[model samples]
Target: MLHLLPLRTPLAGLGLCVLAGAVHAQDTLTVYGIADMYSEGIWGGGGRVSRLQSGGLSGSRLGFRGRENLGGGLNADFVLETGLNMDEGTYGQNALFGRQSYVGFGYEPAGRILLGRQYSSLYNLSSDFSIFSNLSNGPSSAVVGGFGGYEPVRGSADSSTGNGGPARINNAVKYESPVWGGFRFGVLGGFGEVTNDAGGNRVVDAYARYAQGPVDIAAGYVDDRGGSVTPLAHRRSWIVGAAYSFGSLRLRGAYLAVDDRSVANQDGSGWWLGADYRLGVSLVKIQYVVNRPRYIDNARTEGLGIGYEYSLSKRTTLYTGVSYFRNQDGAGLGRASFSIPSGITSGTDNDLTQWVGGMRFSF
Candidate 1:
């Protein structure tokens, strides 16, 4: 058995698991976090953001998690993660523990079933082929609408729950299968908690991946019927990506397509290619990505980025990188992941450039 303190103010699905249990001697708890900051500037007329900022290379966050063994190949676990804005001394995500908060059960041979707020399989699958790990300031987030709902391209919260439901689904149930020979899969569904409307604001996602040897490949899909009342918020998207490595060098690429079912003319399609080379504690990376508006003329977006990172220790590192994007033909695409409190827009036809230097600590 396991026991957890009830949340100060419950948010629907939360606190249910805590109320149903008590801590057991077999349970284990631990804390973990990361702090990252950077100094950045644009090439030409740089904005007011020539100063320091948080989350240049990674988001700062604190998390508490634990798991308990229950014999018979079964166990219980939970995670509570809160995003930190090291720059402003405030929370990053909109809500408390906004990064992730969930509870679940695991059956060794079968898989794990989790409930609460958690990432969808589409978000998880991107890690296999996204050289940038879908960072907010990276190419993947600019062109890949399916990278994650938190991307600038999809920042608005769902109307039903007023949350980042599409990025990290709320009131959702998920199942992750055990990996077998570098292969694994998962499925999830976010229930639309509207009154008497089963299809309103419903979201579904799934993915499969294979990671063996020096090669990796993955594909993901997401369908969101944002609001049953209006068809203006619905969308269907998918992505396919693969990577190959030679010695200390790794190369990767991905193709993405999005159907703006709500506004057909705003659909997007694009591809990206990236590479990384690691020399002991030092690493070098580069990538080029583009996005083309489906039915809009002169609205194509593309850019190139290069970066370097050197580790000072096992949990510390200093890094720097530069990126350039030409929003020609009204391409209007820019960094949608990590904004430095300055105004940045995507799907614009203006060229954009930026260089950033920063350090990170992980524990």
Candidate 2:
């Protein structure tokens, strides 16, 4: 079990002593981060807009991770990560360490167990099999929208609640199995912590993946329960994906389905297909995605994206991309993720287009 202690100044000396004594030659700690920013121009919703934003390709973050060896192939590990908004020098997820905060133990032959806030198994599966790397602005982003509740409008709460997706889960306990013959699996459970309610706001996620040589395949499932009402409502989702690489070229595809029991007419399915080619220090990629609502007539959205990236150095890259979306029968899908302009109107068929250029640095 894990214990928490108040961080009072009076205990500073004792804390330092404990930390100093805990370290050994085999223990390791590291600090790492990524800084990504982009300039974008969007055309649609009766206007044209230009702006600077963060997380064009990947979210900016600072993270600290450490592992302490305990002999016999056993180890203790911890990670704390915070998301950053590079455009405005602010927090991305509304909380410090909102990206990830977890501590766990690992045994070489027995797999691992972790506790705290972390990414959902469904999100990890999408990221692993996507050729676009599952960027929020990439074409393949739509495929995972069902895993997390799909919000047609921007600036709304996207948490794992009634109608939201399961991007991340809080107060979670997770178990990950070691790879055996190129197959690996994991499970996660998040507790709502509500008094007298065991099923309130609970989350259950699981996934399995197999990778050998240049081919990879994965599948995942999630059941998210919302406790806001007397009887909880569930958002259940499932997905399957695969990727293949041959020489400098790679292809990827995925299919996802959602059954939202809390809301009417929210059931849907989405799919994406994409490919990328590498040439020396440059890479080119393209993807197309389609999303269809099960109960809404003619309510569907399709997206197409093409991007180019050039490596400036081992730690820096330059990228540019263009994306287009066609919304039919009152669908409100946009080109970019959370950064979509407010002018776009829902309940009407609209076409959205975006152009972006960005630079990313990692350390």
Candidate 3:
């Protein structure tokens, strides 16, 4: 359920009463969430599995947000959001408020400043410009971002290593600029907070985006310094993406590259192209992605995905999708944003496939 609450305060003193009246008129709070679940059959790693899962099209989440207008075109706002696993009735991201927790202030013409855990700039770019919007299932750019676990840049609670890049940074400070001529940019820095080590597990990310009319373009970069007790490797990644819309059809594409400084020949790159078409209340999407690893000999993976969505209402949707991945030379890539089961390995020249049907409700 979603709720909006208006706050009011009555003060004892007449002067205080006047102050409360001014503030009460500008404060608002809201609670909202999405519930998503899917049934799927996945075939890969020499086995087939059928089950129900959460987050097929989008991750389920609950969140609270509030904003206070401080007058003079300035405002303060905060958000607390948590991911949910609808299937198992569990927390999705391991930590409470793992999806996002931040407080910030914004000026109408200047921009905003925020502090706390938040999404990385690279993730924002990829999600915005991709047809799937980096959903948890089907053919998503997440697979390319985390290919072979060499560059899992998605934010996580773990700050000790950069094995998977932080999708959301912890203990972070961020700044976002106001849009100018359809251009805007943001920067974020995450503090590792390791004792006696200022730079341990640190993260720095930045992104710039421009959108006008039917064209949108964006680029982002992230550098994660991995290490808790001892210094490990540093993971650096960059991405560029673009999207164009014409009538009922939208086309998008993105390219991403990753470099791990700890190991030689561990760099990799990936890219995807996708399109979406809308017909009345129904939508169709198709995407193709490729991943190439520099460390593996002739190791590569390609994925194709097709999806359909029907809108029953503004708040309800029915969706189905299928994805197929072809892996060569021991490349062990699985479905987008999903992990291969433990003890099951995709051997050389193996292939993987997934079929999913689901419903989503938002409030």
Task: Compare the candidates by TM-score and give the number of the best one.
Answer: 3
Ranking by TM-score: 3, 2, 1
Per-residue CA lDDT of model 1 for 1-363, tens digit only, reads 133433343452254436333333335655688999888776422333476677766778888787888899999989888989888899865778877899999998999999888875545545446666666445544455522232323334533343344557777888989889999888888887777777777788788889999888888787877664553567676778899999999999888776666644367677788999999999998888877666666666676888899999989999888887665654333433344344443333355677788999998
Model 1, CA-based lDDT: 0.69
Among the numbered candidates, top lDDT falls to: 3
Q: 1-363 in candidate 3: lDDT tens per residue?
A: 543445443432334434233334547666788999999887876777888888877789998787888999999988889999888898866678978899999998999999987888777777877777776567777767553354444554253353224677778899999999999999988887777878777888899999999999999998888565336657788999999999999999999888878645378888899999999999999999887776777777788989999999999999998998777765454334466554344554367788899999998
lDDT to native, each model: 0.69, 0.73, 0.77
Give the Cα error of residue 132 in candidate 1, in Å.
2.2
Which wins on lDDT, candidate 2 or candidate 3? 3
Ranking by lDDT: 3, 2, 1
In candidate 3, which residue pairs get closer than 3 Å at backbone N, Cα or C atoms, i.e. clash?
152-165, 154-167, 155-166, 155-167, 155-168
Shift of residue 126 alpha carbon in model 1, Å: 3.3
Q: What is the lDDT of candidate 3?
A: 0.77
| Residue-pair clashes, model 3 | 5
